[model samples]
Target: MSEVPQARRTCRRCVLPESPPDITMDSEGLCSVCLEAQSSKPQPEEELLESDFTRLLGKHRGKQKHDCLVMCSGGKDSTASLYYMRKRYHLNPLAFTFDHGFETEGALRNVHKAVEKLDVDFLFYRSTFMRDMFAKIVTSGSGAILCHLCSMWYMQVALDIAARYDIPLVIAGWTKGQSAHQGTPSNGAGQAGNREYASMSEATRRFLATLKQDPKYRDFPQSMEEVLKRARRRHKAIVLSPHWFLDTHPDEYVELIRRELDWEYPDLSYPAKSTNCSLNFLAMHLSLKHYGYTHYHVEQSKLIRANQQTREEALKDLEFNCPREFLASLAGRLGIELPE
Candidate 1:
């Protein structure tokens, strides 16, 4: 028998680089994080978990006050939040989704299922300039550091909807996993509404003033009138993460929703969504190779710490090296070629 070369240790799914923190190797050539994740652990009772979530829902729920604008993406967490608001808290919320130009069919299916169950009004806003704008943002390299731009677009659409309808609270399915980097309860909506309102207000002014330095973003600043209006809204973007709150396993959570909601799984080769937002995946790939980390690294790391996912499971899900094909496609779409 001849000795064979040991294959480079990489994730089974998406391509995460070999150099990541707390990464351990197993005898089978798998990361310890993945192995532990594959194994299961005891969790809280689903009923009890549901009860606790209901209590949290009530704390934020207000019927007499204006309705809440729930930013839903048709994902498991957001979908579950819909049920909590309706069945548990009993708040009249209007569901909102931003057509980021790239949504999978699975995501779309869940969106419909969620709204149907709640029997609430739904809005899907589409930005005509998203495709071109996103392409430019991603390629400009500025997007890599300023991912908040993409998030801003999502929230802006939701906020505008809330403004038009006079919805005071803008509820979103954000949890500790989403904003773990910023240590606080207000992490859900970024620095939109903290006691530091004075500082944030001043910062926003300076930030917009500086926007003129960039020709691409010069005319993109929100007007002073718009800023004042947003401030008056006192928008309460509540964080709702039903999966984390429920204390259910990933597979079990999905199965429970699937069975309870009578939701039919969409048949799609591309893992559900197929929207105009292919650039998202492409950006992930580039960020992975260039920075040795994908968006999921920081994003999913929070979930791992929250006990939502084992570190190993998160590592696997977080893997996604920059694929050449995706890069080329994105470049062509943006009317650019890979730099020599």
Candidate 2:
């Protein structure tokens, strides 16, 4: 196991630590997951290009005023995606954002700025529908990952909105490390078959299995798989991300958004410089306490393994800088006492 200080033992070669059955460390300090990956010969897919994005957009273009429904988080990746859709690809996109009552003021402001600068139709959905569920997870000490739940909710919302508007493409801000597709949370966090999310996903599934028994959440979808399955029956919309097609580094896009959209980073976030929700603090703390690392750790570690990021940078970004008292306060808002 790595002796490094991350408030837990981590793999020597990667940031992920000894979250057993899913992640484990050998005598050499390397993680078991990495070991398995090393032994397997995996095939790499073709790198997506701007032309590919253009071609895909062309397939659904002129069908409506908006060619795609851009899931703008008001973050750099999403803002840049909106910019590219408007300026580079010359495709009209319906900018969409949703807040389940935990969004930061800066994130919302960033979204508004990007939408205004792009001159596109914007749709903002704010609701506290999931607030009770969040509270239930905390108060009951459920093992479900908050981000996974939120992604499933928002993805269903995005698909519903796309279907209603007759738009055919759903644009997301996800990078390569974030997920394989928008249907799953970052890096298959809700995908039970994904070995990377093995233990984590199982816990989420268990919690969801129990959550489904409740009359309040009885109709809730069990997984991202279920959400996507239902959407496929009604919507022909295709989900994609600009970052996947573009080879541009995040730093470059951050600069572009800063100049064009007048974008600024959120003052508070789990991973530095990224725009995430306030509930993310509670999620991070719980994930760390329960699983030893958050999904951000998994994403950054993937980036490092892919040579897109360094371990040093990933560590710094995933470091828990918040005080325990503040995290407890966040839980208090949800009407629960944070576990020690």
Which one is best on lDDT?
Answer: 2
What is candidate 2's lDDT per residue for 122-157, written digit by digit as tens? Answer: 999998888788888777777678888888989899
Candidate 1 similarity to native, TM-score: 0.62
Count of backbone collisions in candidate 2:
0
184-262: candidate 1 lDDT, tens digit per residue: 2122245442221222233334444555676766655344334334545665444345545555554564676666665
What lDDT would each prediction earn against the true structure?
0.52, 0.81
* TM-scores for every candidate against the unseen true structure: 0.62, 0.93
Best by TM-score: 2
The stretch of ten residues in a row with the least summed lDDT in candidate 2 is: 180-189
**Candidate 1: misplaced stretches above 4 Å?**
1-66, 141-147, 180-216, 219-250, 262-277, 302-308, 321-323, 330-340
Q: Report the Cα lDDT for residue 306, model 1.
A: 45
The lDDT of model 1 is 0.52
Question: Which 10 successive residues of model 1 have the least lDDT summed?
Answer: 268-277
